[model samples]
Target: MTCPPPTATLRPGQLRDPFRLLMDVTARHDGLVRLGRGPLGVYIVSHPDYIRRILVTHSGNYIKGPLMKPFRTALGNGLVTSEGELWKRQRRLMQPAFHVRQLQLMESVIVAAVDRAVDRWAAAAETGRPVDFLDDCIELNVEIVLGALFSTSIDPARAQRLRELTSEVFAGLASKVWTFFLPSWFPLPGVIRYRRAVAALDAEVHALIAERRAAESTPEDLLGLLLDTVDAETGAHMSDQQLRDEIFTLFMSGYETTATGLTWAAYELARHPEIAAKLAAELDGATARPRPTFAELRSLEYGKRVIDEVLRLHPPFPIWFRSTVAADDLGPYHLPANAKIVLNPHMTHRDPAYWSDPETFDPDRFTVGRFGTEQRHAYYPFGKGSRMCIGERMSQTITQVALSAFTGTFEFSVAPGFEVVPQYVVTCQPKGGLPLILRRR
Candidate 1:
C-alpha cells in the first residue's frame, strides 16, 4: 500500500498557538493539507469523502497513532486505543451497558446530577453572582458518568483527586506536539508529569478495583458487569491492568467531551436570549419536571437540536489523528505510506460546500428529517467507524437530561466579554470557564 507522492507542498511554521494555528490552517485548505515539521507533522482532512475513507471505509489502515498514546499510557490498552480483536472484544463486552434500552436505567442518575449542579446555580442566582457554567457542567458530567458506571457512589474526596490528576495528565499532554515519540525514560517535564500522573491514577484505580472485588455481593453496575464479562472464545476476563485502562478511558472520553458540548450549548443559549426563550418554551410545553425521563427525551426535540448544533460548531474531539499504514490516493493528492493523517471535523462541520451559512448556529438545520438523512461524513461529532465513541448514546442522553433539567429551572445569559476559546488536549474544551448569569424564571 505505497502512497502516491505529495501533490501540494507541505507548509512550515511554528504553531505556537494551537487554536489560532488550527483556525488559520482550516480557513485556507479546501480539504487535506500537510503542515508543520518533525513529529508534529499535521495533515488536515476536511473533505467528506476523505473523512469517510479514514474513519470508515478503509479505517483499518490506521491505528490510534501518536496523538492518543499519552492517554493510552494512563489508560492502558483499553477500547479507546486497542486495535483488532482486542478492541472488538472489549467493545463487545462494553456495548451492552450503553445500548439505547439500557440508557433508560441511567436517566434518573443523570437528572440527579444535573439537579445538584442547578441547585448551586439557583443559589448563585439568589445572590446575583454569575455561575461558572463550564466548571459546573464538567463537574456534573463527571458525577453522571461515575454514578451511571459504578453501583457505589464515588467518594467525593477521591473523585476530586482523580479530577485534578486527570486535568494534570491532559494539560501536560496538550503542551507538546510529539510527547509520544519521547521515550518513557526521558527526563523531560512532560515525560515526568505523565509518569507521575500515571502512577497516581494507577494507585487510585487499583484501590477501587480491589474494593469492588472484595465485596462479597456483586451487583449489576458497570464494575460488576466488567468483572463478569468474559470473552466467548477465550473464556478470559479483563486483567487488573485492563480494568483500570477501561475505567480511565471511560472517565477521559465519556466525561470531557460531553461536558465541553454541554458548556458550548449553554454558551450558545446564553448568547441568544430569544433562542433560549424559544427552547424554554419548548421545554415548558414538552414535559413536566422533576426531571424529564429518558422516555421523555423524544419530546425534547428542540433541546436535542441545540446539542446537535453545538456539536457541529464546537465538536468535542476536533482534529482526529491517524497514521497511514498503507499509502493510497485521496482525491487528487497522493499520500505516502506512514503519512500522519489528520481528519479535521472542525473544518468539515463548517465546510461551505456541505452546509449553508456554515458559521451560524442554526438548530433548525438539523430539524427531525435533516440529521439522519444528511451526508454522514459532513457530521462527525462522535466521530465515524470502528474507533467511533462507544459512549455516544449515553453522552447524548446525559446532555439532553442536563439541558432539559437546567433550562427548566432557570434563565441563562452570558457575562459581558465572555469569550469562548477552544483548546484541545485529548478533547477540545473551552479555554476558560464559561461565566454566565443564571436568573430564576
Candidate 2:
C-alpha cells in the first residue's frame, strides 16, 4: 500500500534558486516529492535506498526519457541519448577510449594544459587582474580535450574556432531545455538558433571526420583510437554518423561538466584560504617544477580528498533524470508508467541526515574511516550503476592532475565581495563566472 506523493508547489520565479528550493522541498517531504502540474510534473527523489533502486536495482526498467529528449535533439543518438541495442553497442565500442592506458595518455595532455594555464595566470598575477575561474576552466578543458583527441594535429586557431562553435551550440541547446515542453511545430527562437548551430557544428565535425578518413595515418590519439576500435562481435567500425554522435557527446560532456566542476572547486578553494594553503602545500610537495606527471600527482592522498570534497559540494551533474518503462514502486511511492523522475545528487549530498554540517566545506568527511557505505551512496558526481559516465576515470585524472599542477604553480584566492552562485545550465557553472586572483606563491 503506497500513496500519491505530496506536491511541492513553486512559483516560476523560484527557478532562480532551484538548488535551495528543491533542497527545501525534498527534505521537508522526507526525500520524495512532486513538482509542477499534471503531464509536465516531475517526481524528485533524494533518498539513498530510492536512488540506488532506480539507478542500479531497477535500471533496466528505466529509459533516458523527457529530460534527455533535448540532448537527443542536440547530440543525435549518442550514448547519453541512445537506448536499447544501440546504446549497448556504442558503450562497448567507446569503453576502450577511457581504459587505463588511454587515461595515462590523457595525464600528459592535462599537465600540458595546466602548464599553459600557469603561464597565463603568471601574467594575470603580475598585473593583479582577477580571472574568471569559469571562463578560464572552460578554455582549459577545451584545450585538454582537443589535445587528447587530436593532439598536435589540430591548429590553435582551428581549436579556438571549435571552441567558439561549441559555445554557440551549447547556448542554443540550453535555451531549449524549457522551451522543449512546447510543441515541435512552434517556431521558437531557441529551436531556430539550435538548428543553425547544429548545422555549423555538423559541417565542422563531418569535415574533420572525412579528412581523418582520407589520411593514410592512424595515430594513437583518441580520435585514432576511436577510429581503430571495432565492434567485437560485428568487427565493424562505428559509422560516420555514430562517430559524430560520440564526438559531439564527448565535447559536451568533457567541456561543460569538468569546466563547471573546476570552477566550483576554485570557488571553495578561494573562499577557504586556509584549505587552499594546505592544498597548495600538499600539491607543491607532490611534484617537481614545470609539471607533475600523473603517477607523481596521484601520490598526494590529500589532493584526492580535496577533489572529492569539491565534487561533493558541487556535483556537476546535479540532476539525473529517467522515466519508468512500466509501473514501478519507488520506496513507498507508486510511479505510473512513463512517469518522469529526477534523482538529485545535489539534494542528497547536502541532506542533513547523511552529512553533518551539510553546508560546511569539509574534505575530512572523506577521510579513511569516515567515507564508508552511506557516504558512497550519498556521493555520485559521475553517477552510479552501469550507465555511469564512461569517462569517469579520465575526468577524475583531469581534475586531479590539472588541479595539482596549477595549484603547485601558483596560489589562487577568490576576489573579495564576489558572491559565487552555482548557475544551473547544462551543468553547474558559476553565475557570471566567479572571479579569482592568482598570486605569486
Candidate 3:
C-alpha cells in the first residue's frame, strides 16, 4: 500500500513512541510509512505482501538493513547481522550445524542442561522459596548452547558470565547513553564497555576454536564443523574474524530467543493455573515418571501450544529491518534504492484481521495441524521464507523439553498481584524478574 505522506520530522532519539507510531502509520497508511526526509528517510513496511516482497520474493533487493550496523560491529559480519556475499558464505559454512539430523545429536546435552536447572529449582521449591524463572531460564539455555557449541559440558560460573555478557551487549543497544552517540561518531564509555565484552567473548570463542582445531580427533561438533568448513568453489575458509562472529551469532541467537520463550511460557503458565493444570495433566497422561525424550516432549502438544501462543503474543525478535538493494515497487509503494525498511512481526501477530481475539491469551487457537494454513500466515514467530530461523527445530525442541520437565515435577504460580508485563529491549522479556512460587507435585 502507499506510504503515508511524511508529516513530521523524525529525529533518531526523538522518536519515543515506536510502537504507537508504527501502529498509527500501519493503520492510517495501510502498513507502510515513510519517515524523515532526504537520503536517509526510513521506510516502514508492515503489510504482509510488501513484507513478503522485501523479505522473500524480492529479498535480494534488501540486506539486513541499518539497525544491524551497531550489532554488526560486535558480530563482525556474522549471519544474524550480515549481508551480501559474506552472509551467503557464513550461511553455507554454518548450514550443517542446524540441520535437523545434526541438531538431534545435541538433544541429550539440552535435556541434561534442563535437568540440571530443574534440579536447582526443585531444591528451592523444597525449601518453600521463590525462584526467578527468568534467570533460571537464561542459565539453562546458555548452558545448552555452550554444550552444543563445544560438544562438552560447561562450568557453571564461566557459562553464567558468558550469558551475562551477551545480554549486556544487546542491552547496551537500547541504552539512551549508548544510542545518543553513534559508534563512529564517538567511542563513549558505554561503547567501550560493549567493546570490552565483545573482546572477552572473542578471546573465549577463538580459544575454543583453536583448541578444537588442535585436537587430533574428529569432533563432529559445531565448533569442529566450523573449523573444517570451506568455500567449496574457491576453497575459501572462515577467517578468524568470521569464525568468532559466526560463533558469537549462534551463541547469542541460540540462547536469548529460547530463554525469552521459556520465560514467557513460564509467566503464562503461572498466570493461568487452569491451562497449567491441563498441560500438567497432558504430561502426566504420557509416560510414568521418567525424563522426557525428544519424542516424549513432542507428544506434549498442549505445552507446545502454550509456547506457540506466547511466541505469537510476545515474539522474541520484535522488530527487524531490511535495506533496499535497488529501487523496487512493493504493492502501491515505490521503495527507493538503499531505503531502510522496517518490519514489525510484533504488530502483525496482534493484527486483528489475522488473529482471532488477537490480544487475549488463547492457546487453543494453535491446535495441531492448523499452522502453515491460510488462516495463520500472519502468525509467523520464526519469520518466513528462506531467512526463516535455521534453529527453529532446535529451539522448539528445547522449549518443549524444558516445559515438559518442569510441569512433570512442579506446579508454579506468580506471586500475588504480579502482572506479567512485556518489556521490549532486544527481546520481549518480563519487565522485571519473573518470580514464581513452586509447589512440588
lDDT of 3: 0.75
**What is candidate 2's lDDT per residue for 162-228, written digit by digit as tens?**
9998898888776665543455576776677778888888888888888889989876788888888
Structure candidate 1, residue pairs in collision: none
At residue 237, give the lDDT of candidate 3: 79
Candidate 1 per-residue C-alpha lDDT over 1-441 given as tens digits, one digit per residue, 9 for 90 to 100: 334322333445534565557667777877877766555565777888888888888888877766566667666788877888888888888877777766766766777788788788889999988878878887888787777767454677887887787777656656643455455566665577777887887898888889888888876677777888887778898888889889888877775788888888888887777888888888888776746777777988788888889999988888777788887778877877777776778888888788889988999888756555444559998888777888888888888888877777788788777777777765677777888888888
TM-score of 3: 0.90
lDDT of 1: 0.76
Better of 1 and 3 by TM-score: 1
Task: Encode model 3's per-residue lDDT on 250-301: one tens digit a residue.
Answer: 8778767898888888887777888989988898788786456766766777
Model 1, residue 103: what's the lDDT? 73
When superposed on Cα atoms, how far off is each prediction in RMSD? 2.6, 1.6, 3.0
Better lDDT candidate (2, 3): 2
Which residue pairs overlap in candidate 3's backbone?
61-325
Please report the candidate that would top lDDT against the real structure: 2
